[model samples]
Target: MKNDVKEFFDNSEHRPPKFGVLQGVKVVFSAIEVAGPLGPHFMAEWGADVIWLENVNGGDTNRNYRPSEHEHRNDRSMSLDIFSEDGMAVFKKLVKEADVFLVGGKGPSFIRKGITDEFLWAINPKLVITRISGYGQEDADPNYIDRPCYDGIAQAMSGYMSQNGTPESPMPAYPYVGDLFTAMFSLSSTLAALIRARETGKGESVDIAMTEVLMRLSTYNMVDYLNDGRMYPRPGAKDPIQGATGIYKTKNGFLFTNILGRKQMKTLFNMIGCEELYGVGDFKEGFSFINLNWDKADYVESKVEAYFKTKTNEEHIEIFDSMKVAAAPVLSFKDVVEHPQYKARDMWVDWDTMTTEEKYKGVNVVPRFKVNPTKIWRSMPHIGYDNDVILEDLGYSEEQINELYHKGVIFRNDRDK
Candidate 1:
């Protein structure tokens, strides 16, 4: 495994030093787009020897996407016809040595391709197979089990979309939160399975459904209605269950505040010239100061809103800061990029990209580690960029590799070049 990692660095024209906790973990994944490829992307960053399998036909759906560069880094790309006999033979050989296998598409889709969890377990009993799908592998309703889905579909079906936005219109969170969350869950479950596999010498098949994972994430949104017949109103930019805890339009820009706790609420009310309102009705009850269920919520909210309209966001933020009320000026992307805290935290870094010589600036690796910190060794590769070296590592002779390429069992986008 050390030799393989060394070879990966030595073979590439431009490669950084590798440092991560998953140095010995070998992950082979055949997944496309966001939900599937993104999980292995993290493993690759963390020094797992990840081989991204793309069909010889056209490869992943993200083949032409620009944003895919960041997510596909630090991994080897292999274009193989996995449905063909020769391809399947190569795939099985890879699986035999792999610790984890991530398969995208529906369960039946893989079954028709002669790739099943049982078949894979037969090859390597300790293999953790993570199946990423729209719904799930098993369900009483075939329609749900086999439905074609993407990030938006999952968000819509999981009731996540309905919980967001204003009361009149619900919105799905942007930039594919559904897919991103599912990928994170997939990585987590796969790692858990890996621990169990090592402990008991038994591999486990994890069925990760996008909708199910999104629904799980929306647990807080559903519990109120599930336990009691009370449905919370969609608060848009407000904190759903708390008063004086939402975005307010100021004289300039917006201010967001979450005035919780009795002390904080008293401070906020006094700041807005509504201290009298804080001393009566439900406000007299136990810890009722920011409770949205208060009978005079509309009038109190109006007072707060009217007060905010008189001051600029920055001015209000300063007052809130002095008053010990949690508040912030609603910042745009421009503000965030130029933010002093953002710069001090070193939230962005620049690295070389595969598609060009220019450096790509992106968010740095999160949750910094003191030792074996993850690094981006290389940028995303073109289709089959590491075909020769990967196949060579698999013990195929140079001639045999060329033969596979000639047979259309293996493909490299740069082969002709």
Candidate 2:
């Protein structure tokens, strides 16, 4: 019986099969903040093995940005002082093994630290390196590269803030304008470089400026201004592509409706119990009543607003559904959490936090995959938490790891204590 059991155990599966889109790819991330860190977060979600490298001190400043109670406990921290010789040596070794390198620091700082592109490329010629900055690579004035900037600065320079908000009520846009888009662009470039490497066995450097990415987002407006010399004024909730599409205050919150053409206008009119307006001369097919006469918009909008005020959002939804009109309620954060559509689509997920006893939840995963489903592997790690494990994976022995710790080449909580 013992021999039979032993044989069965030996024959059973020893390791689970690897089944991820980027199963075998390895990425070494030395990025910080949203622009740098988000790149690896995306790559890791897609199944790449990403090792985050941090300095010997506390870690990236972003870790302190609104931490939940649960994140403090489970995350491991690593300390590597890159300014020191031993720290640089360890980092260089890690770069040698990495297929992709992502950095968000400026070129001058990297050059000063001896981690320049030339040095990194020399270590691994086939390495896909992405460098993200506030401004860009070219600058006629030397002081341009020296200027420090953040997401808001990039947004202002790239015309994103100017296009957002209304002409009368202009305000600052979201703070993460360039950072988020820069990460997406960097990831795209990295993937492209990876594909090129697979085909030609050569890699290239991808330089992404946050301002440049933000500028790309405003290309349509730029083209309009360049060709027609007409700067577009800030539009409110109304869409430029489709007229009579805007947000209206409902009984509960808000509702977005688009009654652009005669067909949709007729459907809306019928839904609102104003069926007499459908066959009117001004509402005829290709009449251009709303488009040609601006004053008609105010009259139509006032009637639509008054009609919408007669019913609750739920009632309006039912009416729209029955009429087959394109309409939806403007959902708030609280409403979104309890929304049936989000629940049905499995869009929101809960991640355990280490900062407190109670579990914390956030929107970490987004809806993309349908057939082969994937889950959140872990919440964002604490500062340098995977340091020892990563070093060990790099073939450093326990004794050597300890020695590096004493030399300030690595960091751990117990050592700090």
Candidate 3:
């Protein structure tokens, strides 16, 4: 984390001192929506020179979209309509010079634009091309292929959403869950491909499907079905596999805790002064206690909840820490930002924000390295905020850049608006 943090959001292009794992890598990010942008965003965090390519029309739709004021926006944007003549020239130049090109779109649309693996290989033989889509390019069924889908749709298709919530009314996870899974998956694979390409001098094109990646994430459920023909029911906050692992209500806030084995169960039974409950009614192993006596679940839950209610969140936390159990308060976004736990862990940092001009603060980068930890040096730029500098670096004359703008081929989203 070694950038001149103050100079970043301004008009400077000087990279930070710490070149993270992906140093010297140039990425051309041509993605329309969230899932597509995240790969490059993460690479940017890891010290990649990401030339974020937005659309000439309105840029990435996220610039025009926001769930709410407090929601964490991932700096959504796009640049240049590569279909335009002048824009295509610049795009081709970028491809010829770049190491990695990550393009996000539907299958048909990518083919329609003539943005194929072969085309990319022809431009830069050593470049790694990553293609992200809803279903993916290789889906044999045409009915599902090239179909437009997003986060919620992926969750629904992958059966991840079905495993959520209670039996009464199952619920979907927040929208970003599916997209995030796809992002990390795409980023890691792209990095692997990039490494191989650098060594072999031959590029690789990858196709990542949002639905497939998320389906793989629900491997826990898949194991039960594969091994024992048992499909887990919707769990909500409780373990769908039926373990003594859940969020319990405390006097102040909720406490999330887990008991791994019967030894811990014995400790819990003794702690609650219900030792007779241990190994009772052939409840000897695994989740047999709850599964065999489903009717008594409320009674047992009430007893546990009542015991927890005797203590506050802090007291429970101290006790749990002493007990060597995994537990924590179910914190909200605000609580996370202000919590001492996060502060001690160095998970938050102060920085300028892209959405607003005022000084803002939020999270630290993830996938931390002990030597060169990734740093959020600059806030993501406004639409074409670095057009002059970027074009200058690409050897484009000011006149040529102005001509491109005049021809409606490369205008910023906020031009004379």
Candidate 4:
């Protein structure tokens, strides 16, 4: 794997020397919320020049998500009202330079705001256009085309909520259901498009519906219903396929442990001082032995629960670690933030916010890179913070920039304030 990653960098023609992975790649984004912003955020983290275009007023809604001590939280955004001719002209210029364009939202107003895939493709034939929406790009139902959706709606409709949590404790999970998965798909498709564009000078359009992404993720349950003719209902606490594995309450908190086979079961029993169950009755036949009679599972789980209750969470973790048993203590957000593993991996990035003059921190990029080290250059920018510099770099004169700002086509918060 290391060799493959090394080869990928060594053979790449456009690899950046500083970042060593992505150097000159540019992305123009007019996306909002988690679905669209996340994909481009990954690109930006990996050294892509991401220009975020937003409305002249408040900018992307994600800016107001969870404000950190940092000035602009940790996102990068700029204010440019693409509805205006000047704004459209600036956006077109960016499209000509960008390798990818990510768009979100719906309605004719979106097109009027210059976010249409066709308009983007017209600017640059090689532009990889990734459009994210609620339902899908296609649905015979008239309301589906321009329908607005949030995470909760996607979760309920995709049956994700149905399968998640206990049967009695059916509730929505915190992290947005389809958003992260959709972002992953979007990022994967963008990378694939980049590869294609590199080789064939052709870029394709990628349409990702959050509902579809969620549906694909819920395939295991869907497959059971379709292929095996079995309706897979929610299994509370216990996994249906792996019966003996579950979250067990300890003295301190919850701990998860799984003993799949009879050998593993024996190991678990021995670790917990229940070695008597090894050769007793039909248990000697192992997992296949116990699986034959469903009644045996209850007997085994009762024994396992009895053992788990004897030790505190820390003691159980140590015992499991020493025994090479698959066990983990369920950690809360606070625990995770202070986890030793995350600290060792440098998974949290700290940045100083210009507004607060205090350091704000958050989770860094997913999947740490060894060779091309990822670093947070700065905190996410305030709305239109980089207008002058960006406009100046794009070859717009000071007077022209001021005129555009005054015309309400471009925005700079400092100037506005």
Q: Choose the strongest candidate by TM-score.
A: 1
User: Which residue runs of candidate 2 sit more than 4 Å off their true CA positions?
Assistant: 1-19, 67-78, 106-108, 139-141, 240-242, 260-262, 265-284, 287-303, 368-372, 414-417
lDDT of all predictions: 0.82, 0.65, 0.71, 0.69
Clashes of 3: 5
TM-score of every candidate: 0.92, 0.82, 0.87, 0.85
lDDT of 3: 0.71
Listed per model in order, the count of residue pairs whose N, CA or C atoms clash below 3 Å is: 0, 20, 5, 0
Error of 2 at 417 (Å): 8.8
| Positional deviation of residue 124's Cα in model 3 after best superposition, in angstroms | 1.1
Residue pairs in collision within model 4 = none
* Model 1 regions more than 4 Å off: 1-18, 285-289
Model 3 error, position 346 (Å): 3.9
Q: How should the candidates be ordered by lDDT, best one leading? A: 1, 3, 4, 2
For residue 118, what is the lDDT in candidate 1?
90
Candidate 1 vs candidate 3: which has greater TM-score? 1
For model 1, what is the error of residue 47's alpha carbon versus the real structure, in angstroms, after optimal superposition? Answer: 1.5
Off by over 4 Å in 3: 1-9, 12-18, 65-78, 280-282, 285-302, 353-355, 413-417
| lDDT for each residue of candidate 4 in 259-305, tens digit (9 for 90 to 100) | 56556666766765657766666566464223424545566667667
| Model 4 TM | 0.85
Error of 3 at 105 (Å): 1.8
Question: For residue 219, what is the lDDT in candidate 1?
Answer: 83
